[model samples]
Target: MELSCKVNYALLALLELARHRERGKLVQIEQIAADYQIPDRYLAQLLMTLRRCGIVRSQRGAKGGYLLAREPGQITLLEVFTCLEGTWSHKQESQAASLTQAHFAIEEIWQEATMAATAVLQRYTLEDLRQKRDEGQQFNPMYYI
Candidate 1:
């Protein structure tokens, strides 16, 4: 599946938060931008979107910044993606199908693909992802290894 730049940015922002979750520190947007090499202006807008969705909370005044609204364990990638990118929709049958084909068949295929993706995404929480990252584990292994 193709991901929009906004979605990529959102995920990167979350990963940065996840990495720092153990410290319970609120991260400044500029810090996240600098660390991830993201543009500060762009990152600000994206962070605002995240804030509006309640995925993140912002603070004002000195020593203030942003923090995850919920525990990392309570957040799912799909929830993040959905909040940032909305639901995934398959191509319309009119775009490339036999007009005679049953609607149920097309819907079934879409549902199956959505279900498979959902299963994988649901299995991972932000903290779970952090654990995987900390372990330096790859979900897929090299055939030669």
Candidate 2:
């Protein structure tokens, strides 16, 4: 399936937010975009969508930015995908390149892959993700001074 630029950007943006979930404080869009190399304006749009979905909350004016609407442990990648990517509930029609038999066969593979992926993603919470990232950095080759 073809994922849209918005979906990719939103996922990257969400990962950034997830990393900062422990702070439980508003984080600026500029900071998030800079860390992920994403465009600030584009991220603002995605955050707005997430905000609407009640996944994130934003503050205005000085000392204003954004924060997760819920705790990190309560957030799941599935929810992120659902809010940003939408659910994959529709089955596509057969293309001319494939025969009728191939169409249903391809659909089965697609369904299995989607279900397995969803199951794996739903198993980890944002806090678990943060701990994993922290662990990797701790085991890096660089020795402490």
Candidate 3:
């Protein structure tokens, strides 16, 4: 149930890209790292993996940076999760006769939890997350004012 640092950082970086998608501007890694307080080098590696997965496109040179390969609405949380975390596996090594009824019950719980989590993640896109982010920030004081 725990998310790895790679997954978390990738999501944060993606969210920044999603937010700036409308501007159609390439966002630099330094900006993303600074905004999210993630290590610059670590973020670069994560973005490279995401770029390979076709979730993002990278450009080089002065006006170069990174951009989303597709619209945020088309990018689901599940896609991000799988891209960074890989596929989930429930298999564990065990002997056939080593199972108890309590063990069976616990495994059933795990199965249900995994299914529910997957379904929830698959239902939300980056656009949905953006909306939620904006909504959550509505009550914050405007420092620029």
Best by lDDT: 3
| TM-score for all models, in order of appearance | 0.79, 0.79, 0.90
RMSD of candidate 3 to true structure, Å: 3.0
- Measured on C-alpha atoms, candidate 2 has an lDDT of 0.80
Residue-by-residue lDDT tens digits, candidate 3, 41-93? 99999999899999999999998999999999999999999988887767646
Which candidate model has the greater TM-score, 1 or 3? 3
Compared to the true structure, candidate 2 yields what TM-score? 0.79
**Clashing residue pairs in candidate 1, if any?**
none
**For residues 32-139, could you state the per-residue lDDT of candidate 1 as single tens digits?**
999888999999898888889888888887888888888889988888778878887775546455454676687788889888887887777878877777677656
Residue 82, model 1: lDDT of 80
Clashing pairs in 2: none
Give residue 28's lDDT in candidate 3 (0 to 100): 99
Query: What's the count of clashing pairs in each model shown?
Result: 0, 0, 0
Considering every candidate listed, which one attains the maximal TM-score? 3
- Model 1 has an lDDT value of 0.81
